[model samples]
Structures are given as structure tokens and as C-alpha cells.
Target: MPLGVGFASPAAGVLAATGALAALRAAGLGAAHSAVEVSVAQAALLTVGQYLAAATADEGAEDEGTEDEERAGPGGPPFTSLDGVRFELETLEADGWQRFWAALGADRRAAARAWRPFQLRYATAVCPLPADLAAATAALPYRHTAALSAECGPTATEVAARPAPESGRAVPWRLTPGGATAGAARPPGPGRGPLDGVTVVEVARRVQGPLAGHVLGLLGARVVRVEPPGGDPLRGVPPMAGPVSARFTALNRHKEVLEADLRSPAGRAAVRGAVAGADVLLHSLAPAKVPALGLDADALTAVRPGLVHVQASGSGAEHGPGLPLGTDYPVQAYSGLAALVTPPGEPVRPSLMTLCDVLGGLVCAQGAVAALEARERTGRAQRVESSLLSAAQLLCRLGGDGSAPSLPVCTDLAELAADPRLAPALERAGCTLVRPPWTFRP
Candidate 1:
């Protein structure tokens, strides 16, 4: 809490690879030049997009710094048990929240009072849960607490230590081909980007799926984002950029928006219309939701040959009910990332930053790009999947399962951009805008 996170360098490293992939695309296409550049400062800023939205967004009018932020307390999570085991707790539903607390003998009314704020922690960056919840956990040993969780509901993974040797060896993503005797991929059109001619229909929400689509869009792919008919609720969460939330703008500014209720027949038809000629179809729908909506991979790829279908999942959809719901925090806990970034001698915690989400997005983009390349080479790119679980494995492997080093403490985006340590990376040395993360010079 007192230091900046060690997220940017690794993310910039991924971007560098992305740039290299761009050059590879250029070379493969026999383009005249292939040059790419990525900036770490920019990558760091990208992580703060949502927070910046919360900060700069109008609350009737922009209120300056609030009271708690000035005081020194990272007042959120990674709660500790009386037995001295530290861990993060996660449960997607309110009923699960109630059950977990009930098993711990928490007051029913208090548990009910705590649920909304607890759920909003990620969005608001602070959770003012009733103190009773902590008191309940503090009274019990971790084993008791964990046993209750397993018996009833909610996931209570112990903050992990460095994983086994095999953790370091897992690939970030898996690419499965459609079939044999494939047609060669069509040449990308002259649209000024390595992926210019590619069209991607994106049906996703939150960071991972949208971020992947954002990366693809940055690479000059035509990205069409499908949202609910009323639009994503996060759009109105404040810190507006012109009309929409700055966080939304940061992730989605480059893509086209199509509002459709995927639960309806008309909505799926609309998405099918968009994907009719598209090269890629990406979604973050729940594992079963996609099939329920009649958009399963087998059906689509069968109908439209050579389509690169990427699913950004929380856990492997195939794993089914064995894993935590694929949100950023729980995945961090389940995947061992909470432990990797936890400071030595401190309780393990999921990062305030969406580390796995960002990395998952990058990995998804990487898979999509690789799939595109495979299609070009083998003429068949089929189903591709990236999960927060996989990202956590790769992150813990990349960062090691050991406790994380201390980082500079900058409370929010404003303070982060102004931190003197980041001066060299800043274009103006103090600008809110970090350098653009990627550059293509032809």
C-alpha cells in the first residue's frame, strides 16, 4: 500500500512483443518497413484508466481530494485470520456472501449490510464494510474459516507462496487449429496497420475482454464492441471523458459500439450480421451463456470457415464449477497472483490494480494475433481461449511466487502521474497522459 506496483514493466514487455508481432506481420506481407515502439509509462497509465475515471469524473462537480485518501490506510482487503494465515476472500453472489459470513457466525443483518459495499470495492477502490465481518474472521482460525467456506459457499484460498516447478513452465495461451487443408489467409488491406484489414466483433465487458479488443483496435483492426441495449453501466460511473466515463473511453475509444441484448434473438442476429464478414469474433460471455445464446464455437466456425473465435474466460470454461468465478480479484486469489505481489512478511492480497485482467487481455491479444498468423500460414485458425487463471499462472511464474518488492506509494492516478520516480517516462515529465504505449513508423 505504501508503494507503486510492479505492473508496468511486465506489461510493457508484452507490448514490446506485440510490436514485434506487428513487424512480423509487415515482413510476412512484404511491406516496405517494419518498425515498432512501446513505452512503459504509457503502459502504466493504461492500468490507471478506470481509477482516473473515478478521480476526474464529475460528482455533481469534481470534488478535490477526499478525506480518507489523505490519511494513510489502504483500507480494503486481504483479511487475516486469527490463526495467522492471510488470504483474500471472494464470492460472486450475495447468497454466497451471506453463507460465508453465516458459517463464521457473523450477524445476519450485518452480513446483509456489508454485501453491496463489498461488491463495489473494485469499482470504488474502497469498501466500507461493517466492522462486524472482520471481527467474525478475526475470531476464527484460517482453517476453520476455510473449512466453512468449502462446506458452504465462497472461495477462501490461502495467499499462496511460490508455486511448484511446473507453474513456471505453462504456456500463456493455447492455440487450437480448425482443420487440415486450410486456405491461405487473405492479405491485409492497405489500411495503415499490420492488422488493418482484419475485422473483429467483440462481445465482452470489464477489463480483460475489452482490453484485448482495445489492443487489437490499436493495431488497426476494425473492432466493433457489442454492449447491452442500455449500454454498459460503467459508462455512467462518472469521471466522464466528454460524454462517457473516462475509463470506458480509455478502453473503448477506438472501437465502434453496438448495443444489443445478447439474451434475445434479435441481438444474436445483429451480432451475426456484424460477424458475417469479420475475421475474428471475441466474447467474454459466461461459458454456458454463449451456448445458450446459440453462438457456440462449433456452430459458428462450422458456418463461417476460418474464423478466429477467442473467448476471454474467468477460469477455463471447460473446468466448470471447479474454479472461482473469473473476476479479477478472485482469479488473483485462485491463480496465485495475490501471493506473488504480496510484500514479504505481509498477508497475501489481490492487487488494487487489475494485474491479472491486464495480463489476461494482453495474452488474449497475443493469442488472437498468433491465431491470425496461423491462419495465414496453415489456413485454419479455430477456437482460442485466454483465462484470468492462465494469466495468474504466467504472472506468478514471471514475478515468481515469492513476496513482491515494495513499490512507491502513489494513492491514485493523479498522484501516480506526478510521482517524481516516473519523470523520465513522462512525455512532459508531469503530464496525466503518459507516452503512447505503441508507435508504428512506416
Candidate 2:
């Protein structure tokens, strides 16, 4: 049985499914593992390896000016666009932080004024730090003096706070197996592939949850994507053919789509009916709405017995009391990704693509797969949760590899599909730039 729920981006779902497959292999339930997860892990390792290579280069050199220049590039105003447009700030070193603070305006200043030094430097958009200055302010409380030498201009207005600690041991995913007394039986279906007999009911919108379902479908699960009455809001996003969004098509290719509004009684019944037969139930609804929809882990598992329930959110369920309003962009800013990309004396430049959302989806998928494997062993249902914030933190932990080659950004997926680098994958998937990085051989 496989059930995964997620609420972030397509990437979370993809990763969660991959994670489930990995757990299955680890549990000796199958011989195959998720190629997607392996590919992602390799990429992350390569990045860290590059960082290590750079860090160890000419360690004994007193003045590594060449290396430093190569890492940061020739000192100039930070670039604001892919086309290399630069924004200039006319302020001396002494006035840099003051100008930045003043430019932030009153509300942003009030929110950021109390940040600790490391928090300010890592979390806020005050300014960029010179190498010596960054080293000096490493552990101190944020101070007006430190602000004076900050070189970056005002960017974001929101204050970044550390995520609250989990109240108890944080389980990445949950599993609940059917009791022997409850008549736990293997689902009736021919194994289609690695996830052959698994049936996933995806009651989620946007990228994260749906994407996970999509990956499961690729792996041979029968994934049903439940949408609200009219359809998912993402279906209307631009670059459409007819009424379908290309982005939507890219993320959701093989899954079955259903329309049911959870807000109505009939819709709720429809959803429950779908889940009743499903091995996995995945959703990305806000925590506050779960109980109302009768989709909460405890509620669903009570009826389904051994159902695997997964939830994807912007933040962990316990961290933010009300509805989680986070998305990839905000998570990136809060997680210090913006600062990493921004050059000195410039505004923060977020990646053009939704990096956190993608990663979050993959992680959610991984957790879901792991839970499925646990259920097979324990005959119990499992509750799994993932968030964009957590995904961002994981990405940051990978650190930087300044020595890696600079690759040009691909503006068009169609163009990328034609490139020799991706042509084989594109041909096999029968789609343009829509294949998962790894191949799945039966």
C-alpha cells in the first residue's frame, strides 16, 4: 500500500515517492530503488564536493586573491537580471548600512532592528558583508555599527525567525498497518511496476502533492488526482494550450483527474469513497482545514484502518498555529537562499525557478514511500508530513561550491529538450523536457 500527501510543489511529491521506494528496498520488499532520489542525491553530493575542492585549494597561500576573485567575481554592483543589468547604490562604506536601514523604511526597520547579528546577516536583507566584516560579526548581536559597513541594499521587508523546535521526537513519516484481527490483506491488483498494486488518492492542488501523485503513476501506481469543482487553480496558470497550462501538463501527465469540492457534503462523500479503496491518501490542505474535510490522519485512519495519510504544508503543522500561508519564494528568503545568490551592494535575486517548492515535493514523496514500506511490515497506517521550510533548510545545509562551472540558464524547456544533454530522456518520455532525471528499468 502506498499513500502520500503533500502541499508544496511538484518536487515534493516526486521526492516523497522516491523516498518510499528507497524505504521499500531497504526493508527488502523490493529489489528496485527510486532512480529519481538517487539522481537528486548525486547532484547534491556533487555540489558539496565542489565546495570542498575550492576550500582545500592552495590552503597555505597567504593571499588567495586569485581564488577570492574567482569565487566572488570582480567587485561591482550585484546583477539584478539574467541579462546582467546591475543596480548601483551610491554610498560610502561608513554609510552603507545606514543607507540600507533608511531605505528599508520604518515598518521593515522595526521588524528587523532586534535581530541578532548572525540572524541579521543570514536572515535579513540589510546588506552584504565584506569577508573580514562577515567573519567579525559572526556571533555578535546586530548593532548599528555593524549596519554601517553593510554593502547590500534593502530587499525584503519580512523578518526571518528560526523555526520552532518540534515538541517531541520528529518522525519524518508515520505508518499504521492493518491489525491481524482487522483482516489485513494485500491489495487486489497485479503489480504494475515497483509500486505495481499501490493506489494513491491525491486530494491536493498546486505543485507539491499533485507532483508526488504524478511520480507514483509513473512508477505504476493508479493515482487519482482529486480537484475542486472547476479544476485546480494551477490549470489556469499561463502558457496554455486550450484550457490546460503547460506547467500543469508537465507536472501531471499520467494521473487520473477527478473533480470534487471538499467543502460540500456530496463532495466530501465523493472524496471518502475514493479514499476508501485507496492504499494511500495524500493531501496538501492547511492543517486547520483537515478536520473539517474529514481528511486528518486520525480521522481517515479510523475508517480505513491501515491507510497511509500524508500532509504537505508550508511550515510544519505545529509551528504556525493558523493556516500555513508559506510558499517557495518566502521560504527561500527566510532560509537565506536570497542572500546566497545576491552579490554585494545589490538587492536579493531569487532563482527564476521555484527551487524550494521542487525540493519540498521530492522530500514529501520520499517520506510517503518510506511510510508505505513501514506499513507493509507493521500492518499499520502512517501519517507523514513535510514542509517547504524544512526543504529549504536541507538545501542550505548542502553549502556552496564556488568552483562549479557557471551554466547558462535555460529560458525554454522546449529548447532544452532539443539539446543533446537531454534528448535521450525527452525521447523516452515522449515529452519535451518533462522526464525525471533517472531511468526506471523493470
Instruction: Give all TM-scores, in the order shown.
Output: 0.83, 0.62
* Top candidate, metric lDDT: 1
Kindly provide the TM-score of model 1 when superposed on the true structure, using C-alpha atoms. 0.83
Estimate, for each residue in 288-354, the C-alpha lDDT of model 1 and write its tens digit: 7788776777777655677888989887644644366677887777667676676667666777777
Error of 2 at 206 (Å): 1.7
Instruction: Please estimate how well model 1 matches the true structure, expressed as its whole-model Cα lDDT.
Output: 0.71
lDDT of 2 at 346: 47
- Report the error of model 2 at residue 261, Å: 1.4
